[model samples]
Target: MKKLLQTIILLFFFSLTSTVSFAQGYKIIGKAIGFADSTKLYLADVTDGSFKPIDSTYIVAGDFRFEGKLKHKVVQTYIHTKNFADRVSLWLENTTVHFSAEKGKFKQALIEGSQTQNLWTELNKAIKSSKDEKEQYVQFIKKNPDSIISAYLLSLFSTSWGNKTIRDLYGNLTPENKTTSYGKNIETYLALSKDIQIGGSFVDISQPDTSGIIRKLSDLKGKVILLDFWGSWCGPCREANPKLVTIYNEFKSKGFEIFGVGAETSKKQWVTALKKDGLQWVNVSDMKGDKNEAALMYNVGQYPTNFLIDKDGVIIARDISIENLRTKLKDML
Candidate 1:
């Protein structure tokens, strides 16, 4: 009887350990109502605007499941099916979640489970009804500082808000949240943003132009520079180019120069637009489109973003109107 009791105790402890280990990761159970048999389902991990497939499974009787651990406790993940044609994006946490969808309609899937998911649902609903979505995000962070979802939302708004506003919001986050992946991203973003803020010294950028010649922002330091971030495909940028051409002609001899940075993916399109618009300026681009190195460095959230830099290389104004640019140039010249 003594030996049997010892054996039972050991088994009980082993079972408890197994259960705890399984609970440490995420468990996602999914059901697709009209999915075909042997269909492939892929789980993709998203980071820094890129998606990578991490796991895959085949559907059996319209049911599928994924079980794995995440490096970060909370992360953005996507589920793709139908040969990667259909996709559903969701936030994953260390908890079991249930997802359901219909054939060829994965994006409209229903997701359930986890407190963070519930909060995300509520936040989306609020965003749909609120006129000021940024304020709603701020309010949500204020209410749930410990939530990783709040950290993600904060990161999204980092480019729009001022340094002090972002820093204050970061301060409101819990100590644990401050160490999460998105939390660290926010910290890094704020650090970079401080350098490019209005009144701060301009950050230098170097990229190959259409002629394959390297152009550096510092090369035009002796002149008052209009660092224009624009693209051929951007309607507003195209519309504003003619006015900029006029401004450039007027100011070219007054120690003022326009350094146009095209946020274009296609080099052919960029060159064509430049010729068509009759823009005679120092235009340069790395040709990575919106992900252009200069655009990212400047934190340009919109096209036609212009930074008026003084001859001394200090940023004097940002996104100024055509009239404002003219007035400022007249006053300075």
Candidate 2:
């Protein structure tokens, strides 16, 4: 009887311990004013531009709650209604997060939680009024190298700073921080940025032309290449096509070629613009718009960007004016 009693006691203790451990995971206690009773709310884990539902609950009165655990120290999570048209996003950490919002004022929702969220809030306020917000973010990243907020800030200001500055800031992150999604993205961007900078060899790209025929940039290696990243919907790109056409006419017989990569979403619109603009150059696109592989590979953020590559495939200049490009061509060819 004594042995059976001891075994029962151990089992009870183990059950209690497990329950406590499970309860210690991250918890979000939310209250939405004017929200209808039984309104469905969803919690989604965001990674690699995709959403995976984690847990869900419905508002009983104006209150709802979610409690769960995450494997990582921090993960980007979103909370929204069933349609997901309106949502709130925050970093979910092992802490109690308090959220409050009005029915139609989701953007104005109040999120109070971990140190990282606090820092993010502070930075957002500073960004609105600060004249030198870039420097403010740089300092924050420097001071919070171990924090996930640093990685988030790095992503926001990555394109604003030069490659060397980005590299220096990224190098300050902790080993654990370097393993996060944003950190890995920074590493990849830095490597690609360095390889495509002025004086570096042009990175070869293969994309589909308008008719779905694949074309390789390397096929035009023996000619002076103007690698243009543009879109049919871009006003500046459309305006600049006439100038490019003139340049092409002047240099076509002199071993000069323009490889125009269109960052377009719709194939029909892209084809229409190509014919309308009379861009008689080699045009190609993967029809992925902003997420185009060629655009991402070259780190082309702004529209109407061009890189002038020599016959040997080395980038000579980037984003030069038409007159400057004409002068350079006269000098080279």
Candidate 3:
């Protein structure tokens, strides 16, 4: 189930390429070559490490069209065919754009009409031709300090680039650029990451459980704990629940406990998953979705992140698998 709903909003707009046409938000007139008729073309958002299709169309006589208005002025999307072939990442704006590319060479396709797309094209070209990709990225940021693209690029690789380098690059961006959504998230992540790490005592997390009673992580002191950061929408988290149940049943009687913190967007879905998965352990959420307080306190960037705490509340393991948790529990208890 995708988070975004598909709504055909018919508004008024003037198209220079066509006569008597109507579109309010965004319009992408695409000409796809080397694809058979009825091939599906999808515009998907993979920002949160999940594949969600916002709009899609079928190839009719080598032509395809996708029209939708983004809530924001600028957003990122991946245009692809069936099985994600000919995938091309493009930054879209609320403007008309044309995409003309061959079957597998979508990356080299001619995309115009949006200034953000133009910048993306230039940046991609430079990155592809450079010997050291990181250096090229750094140079790009330095050159375009005021560009929103720079901030987004920095945030995109914040995890892989490490905190120091990301901070240095971010320091070079202008105040206006730093105020973008991506830049603000990076700032928040960096600040929160400092408070949580291995060998450090676990931070206290408070959220309402299924019964609407608030529970605190500090209350689980003196017991071996696994602080799991997960969501009901995450596939891997659901699949790992059964194994986690087995692990819990084994060592639960030996002062072992699992503190499940859900980074959920909806309370109904969270409660449903808890019941369906038979999660007997204490599960809690603030129901703030990506803005979840517990998730941000732990600086969780992806789903299914966990930390194993010792009896003294010191973080002993950063992300231990269920099997490893069992093994460690057997040795400890």
Candidate 4:
């Protein structure tokens, strides 16, 4: 009786743990990649934040099926194949995902979900409006004196557009124009006001590793840190990895270190890329794209960007080249 009771208790505990694990969500299918003979299906947990991959299965004859609990939220589904534009779907509940394309050429895209269509429509409109607002602000700044609106508009352009065009325009503004309210607003926007760049000075000292081990930036105060933002599947970023590795090896012994922050949603992909690229450095990823705290804090509008911080945690460079990075590091070291 005692042994049977213990067995039941163990099973109950196991069931509870499994339920909790599935709390984030479940999926029947995920990313499908590779050619016919080499095809494979990926299963992912939706709520893991970093979109860490959970499991994988092989597909045969262009058909695949797998089962897992569904979590509530929108998730991305990609079908990757060579010689063809990868098929993508924004999957939600109560719908079997389907794909169709023209003969011999699978590069075409077709989505069947009404909800997904609606979402994309709204997104496109927002993008158009944002672009229009940017243009209006530029012309408005040229003629008007500085005001809070002009300052805010400049911030919007830099943070949203993520280009050099507006910054260049601001620089070319006449000295007489600089004296206007518009010029002052632009200047204030470029320089971080006390309240705006909150906690920009304080490095996150209490962030825990994947293992829940707490580590702080100040703990490695003497090291030159390269805060890298990248993604596993990004081809350009992967191209840059080899160069970064070379630099890291050269300067690692000279008080230099790298802290890579990936935007990959899958732990499996993240780990695979890390090993494949020979990235022997500390790394983390929230897997949430724009929802990442660091990305929001730093106003990262694009991938493959980085900040070089000195030993004292002061940002020394932004969006620079490998040659420039090497030169800067040599000076610091």
Candidate 5:
């Protein structure tokens, strides 16, 4: 009995020591099953439509830890496993967060220790349980006008909700909420979305190719040009490259062309990715990441976005799925 009592006491102290509070930064203590030791996991900042992996760690004995100081006050992030085979979103701040899950079940993990995450989880649960998700979402925003989560949600749906709805939601948000990066993106989307409507005249862009020669959108005037916006850091973009290649190859002989605009922060990374992905098409960028002039003109908040321009340079389709694109090409080509 005494030995058992001593063991329990040791565990109690160990638990206390494991989660010591820090003056600044965050600590994530995690455990998982069904993963080998040394399996790498990545932490990425997913805030404001950006996908930047800031850190990574390898699991050891089903356990891992990540703690670091933020350059600024960031509120949200993502944990990616197996090069994004699975992903789980979390709120990040100066606190200790606990995570545990079975391998391949990261999407179901509870990111505990963040108030914002708590609210996010609660709202998601309510939305999932409710039949009228849109109604619930609207009501939540109306009630929580002061919450940053509401601004985040409004920004997320700004594309689907249209400009008027985004403006209404944005107006309802508190001043503090309106100052976030999400809010600014919402404003930008509202402004830029007006000119880039379906069936509208395609916007013209000019940027330097990997060889430093300028390329213009007008160059592909008579071809079915796909203006693809992607990034070197985007896992989905990299994964989709092979399929893109197949599509390009199948349609290139029939007056189809892919004009890829890489949302790259570094020229080296962009060139390397181009080589690795074997994107055998005209790719261009300003090496300014998302701030590329073309990216801004199109309001490209996320990667893997594309515009489909017909022979006359009219944007006939936007963000169509690969299967739909194939079908469309079959008819048009």
Candidate 6:
């Protein structure tokens, strides 16, 4: 009996020491099971846009331990096992969580104790609602604008049809809670939204296209430029491209030019579409989807969006239809 008691004491001391040493940044202690092969453990520090190696152990015994300091305040924990699948877990400060992964994908939480659970619960409820997407979304924001869940949802739908609706919902928020973290995040997001109002025109700070090299947008100061936003997948844009082609051909000698901003996710698609569509104009894009950074800056919610900038690089019209665009071009040229 005395020997058994001594062994238990020793085991307790060892476990205590291990916990203290590994609990610095974030610690993931769990077992991974592989159906077809052995499982592997990986400890990555979610910083530098890459994961940093810390400690790794095999799951042959169905046990693993990972420990490391996160360079950033927020970091993600990933478990990549061979032939089994991959699992991802998120850890934040001042929280304790216990969960398991199923098929290396969805997390099955059998136990958890954290403040973030509230945010999760709220998001789950918001997503479960069966009302119309737009109206349900508007109602969610109206009720929980002061909660992180609402803030995140609002940010997600800000640039969609929810853009205007979400804005109006926030306006109805109580003034007291408007300065909360959720409120401020929404405010900052809305403030950064692109302004499409006429006058105080937008200038092209980018370099010009002369010398077959880098050029600034300011170089085309005296020429009226038709800034066309288009994509290869857009049938409307394709139909509009010919009209633009006609306009460019007619006005090229009259101090008018065409510049295209493509909204294509794939580089190959953008290039192929450009060639196939016979677009002989200067084009640029970040190669992101409709929610691209540039598109967000320009407040473009729909495709075939554009800005008719005067020679001085001032926005004269936005979302100008083909007929209106033709009339605007005639007046500008």
Error of 2 at 115 (Å): 2.7
**Local distance difference test, candidate 1:** 0.85
Residue 5 alpha-carbon offset, candidate 2, angstroms: 16
Which residue pairs show collisions in model 6?
A: 206-217, 207-215, 207-216, 208-215, 208-216
Pairs in steric clash, model 5: none
Per-residue alpha-carbon lDDT of candidate 1 for residues 71-165, written as tens digits (9 for 90 to 100)? 77678888997467788888887789999998778877889986777788889899999999888889999999999888877776666675678
User: Cα RMSD (Å) per model?
Assistant: 5.3, 5.5, 10.0, 16.3, 9.6, 9.0
Task: Tell me the tens digit of each residue's lDDT in model 4 across 219-267.
Answer: 7666888878788877888999999999999999999998877775567
Predicted structure with the largest TM-score when compared to the true one: 3
Better of 5 and 6 by TM-score: 5
Better of 5 and 6 by lDDT: 5
On the 0 to 100 scale, the lDDT of residue 173 in model 1 is: 97
| Colliding residue pairs in candidate 3 | none
| Root-mean-square deviation of candidate 2 | 5.5
Which runs in model 6 stand beyond 4 Å of their true positions?
1-135, 142-152, 160-192, 205-216
Model 3 lDDT tens row, 104-138? 89887889988888987887888888889889888
Clashing pairs counted in every model: 0, 0, 0, 11, 0, 5
lDDT of 4 at 284: 72
Candidate 2 C-alpha lDDT tens digits along 1-333: 999999999999999998887657799999988878999999998755457899999998899999988888788888888987569887788789999998877877899986677777788888887899787888889988998888866654555465678789999999988888878767766765534689989998999898788999999999999999999999999999999999999998999999999988789999999999999888999876755677767877788899999999999999988899999999889
